[model samples]
Target: MKNLRNALLLKQLYQLKQLGYKYTSVTPYKEDEQHLRLPNTLDSLKKQAMECHLCELSKSRQKVVFGEGDPQADILFIGEGPGTMEDSSGKPFVGRSGELLTKMIENVLLISRSEVYITNIVKCRPPNNATPTPTQAHTCQPYLLKQIELIRPKIIVTLGVTAYHYLTGDDTEISKVRGTLHKQNDYTVIPTYHPSYLLRNPSAKKEVFEDLLKVKELMGK
Candidate 1:
């Protein structure tokens, strides 16, 4: 009974924290500082995201892979979606590819996982790690947009084609998209290679690193 009470109390606290009650920053599932307003906060917002059973990927998912990072972060990195590693771990990009991301983030921004916010276009892991469908993006785009509104990031880094297509509505190849900045609403969106792609084609890391350098310049960090 005590455990149940404590869990309820914690949920209440989280809701309170979400409603502009807290001023400090905090990470989603880690020990870091981030602003309190994020898309996963409002019950209506979460319900909208959770009600999405529009994709086949929803069947196999253990949890909806909503994003994580500083709500008030100056930068945001959007990827394809959770993989086997992220699905099992319930954390974004914590695999061999994640190591490359950590190195790139550190080399570029001088921060660890807890520093920047990370998330995906689709929260659930697609079976066999296939790409998320167009319908999935349609269903999830509003939530992503809401997140952007809540966070208000200055720079948005789209990791590879999946993210690019969702944010920019351009299905063109990533090679053409890399390093170009597109203004959406109030944010500047930058496209780049995903760490997993860099893992497959090591030579592309240089390009990804170069694109990330632009993010560093924007952040001034």
Candidate 2:
């Protein structure tokens, strides 16, 4: 009986390992109960996200990047996930990619970075900055959804393939869809290459520039 119990325990642990969990904890409430407990307001929600432990990403993350910028902004920029600098500083888009994004906003859009909101699909950084697993993204989806509800931006610009995929549920290649506008309920979602991608392939800057032009035009009406 003892050996059988030990084998079962190992099986459970192995299952968790396969799911990308580095740690686990017992919670007092069910998943729905915990989710229902989340506050509605942005500030209150941010505080809750700071203390979030819904998934294993929380174990490795240095901080939970809730989001930043004008809550009432007409535009919201969504990225795939956090990176090294973001994890350390708890701010989205803060390194070279961040600088490029800032430039895009200021130069192309003719607005300051603070005029728009920025965040990631997943609040926490994945291990070694790997793409967030589906489970992790699913765990964080409610938070992002609530943020969208509160912010209610007129436009949502997805910064990469991952952001575009998760937000719109469209598996279309970003190259094929980039710069195209898709209506999501009330808001207009514009798919674009991430700033990080531009950093590696500077040639794509022109393409993103055109996309931003479309966003700017849409903002006018």
Candidate 3:
């Protein structure tokens, strides 16, 4: 019976994804009230995130890079995990790649960096900037889901392969999925290369810009 129920929920989630209705959970927060008190505000959520130790990453992390930007923004930018700069600053997207991302938001989306929320799949930085293991992602996913629930952004731009994989549950390469508009549950998810990748490749900046243009168009709609 439990297995069957799980399967049905998964089916419904997939259907919602197809229909473009992005949200955190099919069941309301009330169902899990005993386990967690879902915060109605981003600040409260950040407080919870700062103390989280659900995974091993927490042990080595200097600080939890909770995320930043407008709590009520219409867009959310999710990346994989934090690197050295992010870990040190206890913020997301404050490094070189972050600077590039800022430019992307300003130049293409025509919005200030503060207009959209920015976060990562994991709150803590993985050691030496390695990819987060599935266990780590699974443990931290609830926090992100709750963030999505609270903010309820109209559009979510996933900024790399890891972010795309975590959000969409799709294992395809970013190259194939980039610039595509996918429906999660209420948000339209647009995947693109991480700014760090663009820094290395340089050539891919054009494609990232194109993806941002699509994001701008979607926002206007």
Candidate 4:
């Protein structure tokens, strides 16, 4: 009986390891509950983020764009990463693409940009605004995950394939996955084309608008 029990315990630990969870004194199952109980104020999270060096992106970042908007917002917009303008100002969504995003919020959602929280997969800008490598994103993913846990938004609108892939771990292209409603953790995720893509191909804006309307509908519920 003792040997059988020991074998079962080893199997349980192995299963936890396979699921990417570290068994500690506190146990892996309580990780989310513990994080939920932590101080989730934006100011506190931003202060910690300012000192973060979890990934190489931090080494080259001019500024860590932690994110900005209503802390208690029911909606969150996540982008790929900081752009040149956002890096310059230490804010998210302030460039040409940001302008488009703001317009969409106003025109489609009938809400001001300030009404929703906006952030990115990685807090720092990638070199020359390239897509963030998977390693960098994985290293910095905890912060975004914490933000989501705190905000507990009704809807999460992921702009671009990077954000979609980061949150859902789904490699589907944005063109293929856009407009589909996916459930991640405890929130509804809606993937759509990034504003930069819409800038290059204005025709895709119609599709993004359709996605945004879905966000509006979900938020209403």
In model 3, the worst 10-residue window by lDDT is 1-10
Q: Give, for candidate 1, the lowest lDDT window spanning 10 residues.
A: 28-37
Writing each residue's lDDT as its tens digit, candidate 1 over 25-61 gives 4432322223222335534555555655645677898
Q: Model 4 Cα displacement at 186 (Å)?
A: 2.0
RMSD of each: 13.1, 7.6, 8.3, 8.0
Give the alpha carbon lDDT tens digit for every residue of 1-221 in model 4. 12223323444565556778775453322223433332457688788789877567788889999999998899999999999999989999997999999999999999999999999998999999999876667666767887887888988999999999989989998899999998877889999999999999999999999999999998773
How many residue pairs clash in each candidate at the backbone level? 5, 0, 4, 0
The residue pairs in collision within model 4 are none
Backbone clashes in model 3, listed as residue pairs: 21-185, 21-186, 22-185, 22-186
For model 3, the superposed segments whose C-alpha errors exceed 4 Å read 1-33
- Rank list by TM-score: 2, 3, 4, 1
Of candidate 4, the 10-residue stretch with the lowest lDDT total is: 1-10
Q: Please identify which of the two predictions, 1 or 3, would achieve the higher lDDT against the true structure.
A: 3
Span of ten consecutive residues with least summed lDDT in model 2: 1-10
Instruction: Provide the global lDDT of candidate 3 against the true structure.
Output: 0.84
Residue 98 lDDT, candidate 3, scale 0-100 = 92
| Better candidate number, 2 or 3, judged by lDDT | 2
Q: Report the lDDT tens digits of candidate 3 across residue range 63-147.
A: 9998898988899999999999899999898878999999999988988999999999988999989998776776677778888
